[model samples]
Target: MPYVNIKITNENVTNEQKKALIKGTTQLLVDVLDKNPATTFVVIDEVNTDNWGIGYQTVTEIRQDQ
Candidate 1:
C-alpha cells in the first residue's frame, strides 16, 4: 500500500511519457522498497504553470524568462 504523488507542470507531456513515468516510478519502489506493484498507487497531478510557483515566480513566468 504505497502511495506516490507526482506533480508536474502542464507543459504538454505526452501520454506515452506519462505512462513510462508511472511504470518507472512503480518499478523504482518495487526495486528499492520491495513494494508490491499490484498494491502500489501512483498519482500524477498536472498543475498549470500559473498555479505552480518557484522562488516567488510562477513556472509560466520562469519559462518566459528562460
Candidate 2:
C-alpha cells in the first residue's frame, strides 16, 4: 500500500478540485510505483491559515500583509 498526504491552506477549494487531486495522486502512484489504486491512499489536509506558517509568518498574517 502507498500513502500520499497533501496539505493545503483552508482556502475555498471546490469539491471537484479535491476529487481531481485524489485521482491524480492515485494515478501518479499507479504510473510510477506500479501500485494498485485500490490499495493506494491519498489524504488531503486542509489546515487553517492560523495553524500553517511559512517564513516564520502564519499564512493568515501573510495574507493580511498582502
Which prediction has the highest lDDT against the true structure?
1
6-45 per-residue lDDT for model 2 (tens digits): 9999899999999999999999999998999999999999
User: Per-residue lDDT tens digits of candidate 1, residues 1-66?
Assistant: 999999999999999989999999999999999999999999999999999999999999999999
The clash number for model 2 is: 0
Question: What does candidate 2 score on TM?
Answer: 0.95
The positional error of residue 25 in candidate 1, measured at the CA in angstroms, is: 0.6
State the C-alpha lDDT per candidate.
Answer: 0.96, 0.96
Displacement of residue 49 (Cα, Å) in model 2 is: 0.3
Model 1: runs farther than 4 Å from truth?
none
Error of 1 at 6 (Å): 0.2
Error of 2 at 36 (Å): 0.3
**TM-score of the candidate numbered 1?**
0.93
Error of 2 at 16 (Å): 0.5
